[model samples]
Target: MITRTVVMRAVRTVVFTLALPCLLVAVWWVASDSSTSVYAPPLRTILSRFDDVWTADRIRGDVVPSLLRLAAGYASAAVAGVVLGVGIGLSRTARAVCEPALEFLRAVPPPVLVPVIMLFAGIGDTMKIAVIASGCVWPVLLNTVAGVRAVDPVATETARAYGVRGAAWLRSLVLPSASPQIFTGLRQALSIGVILMVISEMFAASNGLGYAVVQFQRGFAIPEMWTGILVLGLLGVVLALLFTLVERRALAWYHRSRGARRKAGSGGA
Candidate 1:
């Protein structure tokens, strides 16, 4: 099952993926080595402080809370988006009624609504979670609606003919057909969720990555602030990798089907 060619390809993929980031880090290392500015410390200084600043205690008090909120908000948004999306996608009357309200709400930026949400949800984990969910839900909801609408008409008819009505029809045909688009929405929502997580935490929070970063900045701890930012970036990359793993597993069939179709088309040509 495994071959030298496969191993080589995997190595090449890893190299290409890392090349730009590695290059950028190298450039920064060289550029910042001679820096004497208090605001912009050397990359070496930042790296040296990284371990000390982001110790286990700091991680537990800051990073864990942020991640927990992100997970909770993102999960809730995904669930709500899919459910409402499917319902609205299947009904012309519901779509028409909801379209205007959806448009109006989505147009308002999530950050601007933070104070309003704070008024209702208060200055706690609830507010932060709500903020993240508010921003993340739009992309997932809109994409799901579009994906459901784009399901193959022939497949829908076949399902109906086979007495696969209601939930059976949706489970067997609609959901699978729309999954690719739904995953696209999910990818977009993930980035938004991360951003909103930080933004929400920057306000009225004592123990979170964003709050820590802000405090470091205010206290003129530039190196520690930079480390905080670096940690956030690393966290985002880790979350993205996790999401990719899930997507690949979930969409393996869809990917295989597309590959088959492409091969068939090429052969015909």
Candidate 2:
């Protein structure tokens, strides 16, 4: 049976997908209406800069560095968040104490944290990665904790009946069951990670895409700044698409598991 809820959700998704590119183009067209030197670059002009950015030297010098920093920092955040989240989730006392602090810290904006991080780490790749990792970790940690705690008690008990316990139990039962939530957290973290990575570079750096934007802007290269911004936007879109594909595959078992339960319930009813 097709429920109104499911149908409406599908309709909304279709509407959103259709609306997004239209909105982007509309905004681009409006902005491009101006020929003024400071305000906006024409869409065609921004696209033209891609040839310069994607050149072998530019790719190696700027884009590659930014991407490498992003990946390194984000990867560290993922690993640390999952481990710490698992620890906190599994221990009630730890959760009670740590959750409040984490809550407060997570509420603090990452841009605010950059100066403090830089004070210690300085303006090197270390600072860049540290800032990104700091910004990204909370989402992953909180999500992992939520996921672990959300495991069905009945399923856990069943696993226990088969002698599962400790680390073995977590790997065999918990992570698999909690994977969907974990991935959700990861997707959120990556979003945050990307924003912070650029901001980190923009605020203070001699190289990277953000630095390129800054360099161009200082020299009155508005079109190049527009190009960098556009590339970042496209990068975000591509990354989100990749994550969605991974999410669908990774959560396939979880989806099927829930679907099976639903089918059983409907048959009984």
Candidate 3:
């Protein structure tokens, strides 16, 4: 199963993925080796502080809370987006009724809503979660709507002719057809969720990665602030990889179908 070709391909993939990041790190290390600026600390100095700055206690107090909020918000957004998107996609009347409101809301930036949300939801985890959800929902909702609308009419007719109806039809046909677009929305929402999490935390928060970063900046802890940013970047990369794994698993059938189609086309050509 684990052939030399597979191993070599895996190694090549890893190298390609990491090449840019490794180069950037090397450049930063060399460039900042003798920096004396208060704002821009040496990369070595920043790396050195990782052990002391991001200890178990700090991670427990800050990073975990931020991640939990991000998860909650992202999940809530995904569910709401897909359900509402499906409904709107299915009914022309529903789409017409909701279009204006959707456009208005989407046009308004999520960050601007933070203060307004804080006014109603207060400066609790609720507000932060809401902020993240507000930003994350738009991408998924819009993408799901597009995906659903784009479902092949031929496939729909085929499914209906086979006595597939109602929820059975939806499960057997609609979801699978729309899943690729829905996944696209989800991928976009993830980055927005990360951004909103930090923005929300930066305002009236006691314990969160963003809050910790702000505290470090105010206290003139440059290295610690840099470390917090570094942690956030690492967190995004990890989340993205996890999402890719899930997407690949979920869309395995779609991928296979596309591959078959391509092969058929090539053979015909």
Q: What are the Cα lDDT values of the candidates?
A: 0.95, 0.87, 0.97
- The sequence of per-residue lDDT tens digits that candidate 1 reaches over residues 1-269 is 99999999999999999999999999999999999999999999999998889889998999999999999999999999999999898888999999999999999999999999999999999999999999999999999999999989998888888889988888989899889999999999999999999999999998899999999999999999999999999999999999999999999998899999999999999
Best by TM-score: 1
lDDT of 3: 0.97
Clashing pairs in 3: none
Question: Comparing candidate 1 with candidate 2, which one achieves the higher TM-score?
Answer: 1
Which structure among the candidates has the greatest lDDT?
3
> How many angstroms is residue 169 displaced in model 1 relative to the true structure, after the best TM-score fit?
0.8
Worst 10 residues of 2 by lDDT: 33-42
Error of 1 at 96 (Å): 1.1
Candidate 1 local lDDT, residue 10: 100
Off-target runs (Cα >4 Å) in candidate 1 are none
lDDT of 3 by residue, 47-80 (tens): 9999999999999999999999999999999999
Please state the error at residue 43 of candidate 3 in Å.
0.1
Residue 234 miss distance in model 1 (angstroms): 0.5
- In candidate 2, position 83 carries an lDDT of 95
Ranking by TM-score: 1, 3, 2
